[model samples]
Target: MDDLFAPSDVSWTPVSPKLAAVRRVNAAIIFGVLAIVALIALGMSLGWTYGVLGLLVVAGGFAWAWVLIGRNQRSWKYAEREDELLVSHGIMFRQLVVVPYGRMQFVDVAAGPLERAFGIATVELHTATPATDAKIPGLHPDEASRLRDRLSALGQAQAWGL
Candidate 1:
């Protein structure tokens, strides 16, 4: 069954390990808040009936966090082709965004504190539509820069209709 859906010629690269950690960090923050609420609920269930209401609060928090963390991690994936960039990601929804070499306007390499700690960077590709920003996250800093350069050159050539 796995062979039926696999691409015969395409090479699949997994997301960076640091990206997994980043996703986990997001989950931890949410779960941590829910843990606090759950504790409060336990306190109330003992004798303070008012604390029973805290269960709903904790449950709601858990649900919300579950949705956020679970959904985001599930829908994130990407691939770089010879002439185009493919990004697939979303939370609670799946999106496959393709940016052709010709439509790419610019590529940016950015790093934040968390990414820096992981020694990873993000490569963002901007197109004519400001709202449609495509990004490849969790790249090594050097790889991100090289991709940026290559994408930039291809975008320029494409802009000239070459």
Candidate 2:
């Protein structure tokens, strides 16, 4: 049915460009590690006729990770309304998750060493499921805190039926 494939009835907003930059940095670091491992494997496989296959496998891994990073940078979206907050992302398999304000347990604004270097913060929404959580990254630290405060307040108000 069309409904099965159609996008959900949810508004979406793109993450800040700064977020993409941060993700790219992370991807580069991961790719560098993979390259090193691949080189080591290639050296070990030399003269065994498996070097070519190893190289190909490593190249494919790099390509796959690169594509995944690109998709993550492109597909991430966030939206919040009085009733709920939504985060949607993924390239190969799209995902859209909605969290009602009334169901939110807490909100946290966090900045890791890398994000701090880029003047960015991540807002995490704590709900019942740790797996199906919400994270909005690449916000200015102040902005992240403000959003956290607003969302927490909204959730509290909603709980009280205000």
Candidate 3:
């Protein structure tokens, strides 16, 4: 099953471990807030029984969702080829994106509040068209900057069609 997205034919660079923690914490926080709201609503409208049951269901669902989020985050990977960059993700429904250097107009690396809290960043590649753009997320801050620089250099060096 792993071979479907990550084959031995090419190297795969895994996302940072901090990404899993960030994802887990984010999921927990979101579900925690929703669970609180549900408990209040159900308890007031129906009774304590419905509130308790709803809380338990929300907790269980949060656990399951956290597990799935971790799995999905771990499944993400990116690789750089001579002429293009390869990004692959997903456990069941796999997606592979190839961004050619010749098509790349610019490269950018950014980090949001959540990602900054975890010391991770994302690198986005902008091609001639938005449809062909590719993004690699959950990379270490330094790694993301290095990738941005490398891709920019490669894009310039390979800009024969541009």
**lDDT per model vs. reference:** 0.71, 0.75, 0.88
- For each candidate, give its TM-score against the true structure: 0.67, 0.76, 0.92
> Which is better, 2 or 3, measured by TM-score?
3
Q: Give the lDDT of residue 55 in candidate 1.
A: 56
Instruction: Point out where model 2 deviates above 4 Å.
Output: 1-11, 44-60, 129-132
Which residue pairs in candidate 3 have backbone atoms (N, alpha carbon, C) closer than 3 angstroms, thus clashing?
Answer: none
Task: Give one digit per residue, the lDDT tens place, for model 3 in 41-84.
Answer: 99999997898889999999998998898899887899888888
Q: Which tens-of-lDDT digit does each residue in 42-150 have in candidate 2? A: 7686643565566567667767776667667777777776588877767668776777898788998888888899899989898877765788877778778888998
- For model 1, the local distance difference test gives 0.71
Where does candidate 1 clash, by residue pair? none
Worst 10 residues of 1 by lDDT: 1-10
